[model samples]
Target: MLKSTMNQNKVQTLKGFRDFLPEAMAVRNYVKNLLIDTFETFGFEPIETPTLEYSSVLMGKYGDEADKLVYSFTDNGDRQIGMRYDLTVPTAKVLAMYSQTIPMPFKRYQIQPVWRAENTQKGRYREVLQCDIDTFGTNSPIADAEILAVINTVLQKLNFKTFTILINSRIVLNNILKACKITEDKNSILQSLDKFSKIGQDGVTKELIGKNIPKAKITVLFKYIKQAQPDEYLQNVINQLKILGVSKNNYQFDPTIVRGLDYYTGPIFETVVTKPK
Candidate 1:
């Protein structure tokens, strides 16, 4: 009955969770070390934040999908709390609470685990670690460029290839969304549509229609997004804005991008792998 006993004693992992053994842990540590070294070389200091934060602190920040995915519950003290969803929000809170002590134009790198209740799939996990380095107090484009450059250099060092960096500003997207006649209440609809790259056009279309967005508008929005290269796309967007007489320096029409979260007030970027995954 040894086999029966072994079967009976087998422990099941929770859904959307995983267990990494020693070799996996070693690989993770190695990668983390490389990231740390790169960030330090660029003069970013390290910072740590707690895993659990009051739910109110993170509320109304990361948009609907992110809000839905956050691991939140009432604690023993009967307080609503959540596991950290991303480094950026926590960083913002830290700055708000400890601004007096921290240096201006603070640059910090945080590597930590974030929890989300998303569907589990390859390269996507409900719980995953993020390697984040952010500079607050300075809205300089130079800081943006530096972050991009550091990411590129580090990824190249790791032998990653055939990747494209997509960058844009949320201000630009807000203008476009208004131009498209999509309501603010439907921002999630746009964000969901942006997932077309990962989930395919048909899947995204289904999601949008499911949200009751009109089929014709969705069709036009997809076509408009697909028409031009990065620079050309920005120019086209500028032309459209000029026609509408809306003047804004921040809303650049960056064609290289597909989608990003709502909380990114300024520059937002993503690196997409062009080669097979």
Candidate 2:
């Protein structure tokens, strides 16, 4: 009997992973319920996908760092597979695979765990839950507006304040990078520039210089990002893109944001919470 008990205790979770107990699960369920209710009220439907996906499907979708972090392995059938890294990529694959079957402009809300073979930090874990709401097959601003409104409503109900929602477009960033003569290989440089808020402008400038980006161009880029309003920034970018023969509407320029994700093709946004520590 003692040996059996010892054997049970010896089994443990891998490092950087965890198992939620009942009390924690109850709280999690409650939060998830609230999020589900909010998303459903906004006409977002629930969908689920497999936890395992073909390794090729998830690779290169979330940038180089994320690609390196994917939990890939060979199954008994000698097929390479990976644990789902984020709800978005799997959802995208589902859309492409069932393009003919699913309804157009599919609005989906998914809550699932994603695995990452990376270091954990505060408010981040190797395996964590992501709540995503997305609309496919529509390029309407109304769709974008609805997503923003729904997210704002959910956060308001949660009593979170002192935060702002920053929105931008990847096209706009790409144009800016082009203006600075920075190649696409400078994704890490751009990512560091995006961190200006968290690490300060001086820190970002130093990091960019370290990355071998020109100091004068970095100064110009930083000044551009600090524009006070979206309208002013849009005007400048619109003028620049016009000279380059790119339409203003196509970029969907919004000055309020710099999204962290590399895969976001159109409008991108981030929520900044300023609750007291």
Candidate 3:
């Protein structure tokens, strides 16, 4: 019995996670250092938050999909706690707490591992590293430009050969919905639209219909999504990034790339690796 106890079966790695062997860890550290240097060049200082947060603080910040991916539990103290799903919310909490002490227009970069109880799939994981940079106290176009510039630099510096940055605005969708007279269910509409990449147009139509959106309006929405937004809106965003010296070839205005978050009120961007290693 004592021998059996001593040899209690070795636990397996939980699904959707992995152990980073030395070879991989070395590569990861090398990339991390490069990112840290890039972040510092743009005046971003590093800050960290606890992995566990009170459920009240993180409960509803993300929409339905994210809410499902959060890992929540009751700790021994009988308090509801949740693992940090992303760096954004915890940074917001920190900013509110240190508002008096921190300088206005604070710039920060956080290179941290975030937990997500998401469906494990190729290119998706339950635990992943999120390298995020954010600025508070500014609504400046230059701020947005700087972010795009930094990301473009990071990818190039990392020796990635083929990539493009896709940018879109949630406001564009809101405007389209308003123009289509879709007043009450804008949130539901955005949520459905977010699923387009994963589920395609037919699946989004199904989701919208499930929410009881009229088929006519859904048809109009697909058309609007396919059509380019007013040329002025597209050019305006492009002009800002151009002003910051980002390569025109490296970025584009894609209307279909609505980020899957209800709280995003403005521009959203992502880097797509065309040539994955």
Which candidate number would show the highest lDDT if scored against the true structure? 3
- Mind sharing the TM-score for model 2? 0.85
lDDT of each structure?
Answer: 0.73, 0.75, 0.84
**Candidate 1, residue 47: lDDT:** 91
In the range 1-277, model 2's lDDT, one tens digit per residue, is: 9879979898777777889999999989988999999999989999999999999999988887779899999999999999999999999899999999999889999999889998877766788898999988986566765676666677777777555555676666766776667773657876786776778878988988888878888887766665533434434433444454432332343443566567876667776677632
Clashes of each: 1, 0, 0
Best by TM-score: 3
The TM-score that candidate 1 achieves is 0.78
Model 2 gets an lDDT of 0.75
Can you tell me which runs of candidate 2 are displaced by over 4 Å? 1-3, 6-9, 228-257
By summed lDDT, the worst window of 10 consecutive residues in model 3 runs over: 228-237
lDDT of 3 at 93: 96
138 Cα displacement, candidate 1 (Å): 0.8
Identify the superior model by TM-score, candidate 2 or candidate 3.
3
lDDT of 1 by residue, 1-277 (tens): 8878878989577877889999999999889999999999988999989999999988789877679888999999999999999898999999999999998899899999989888888878888898899888874556666676677667766776556556665655555556577763556765785676678878988888888888887786666656533343334433544343333431333432535567765556777666546
lDDT of 1: 0.73
Task: Sort all candidates by lDDT, best to worst.
Answer: 3, 2, 1
User: TM-score for all predictions?
Assistant: 0.78, 0.85, 0.89
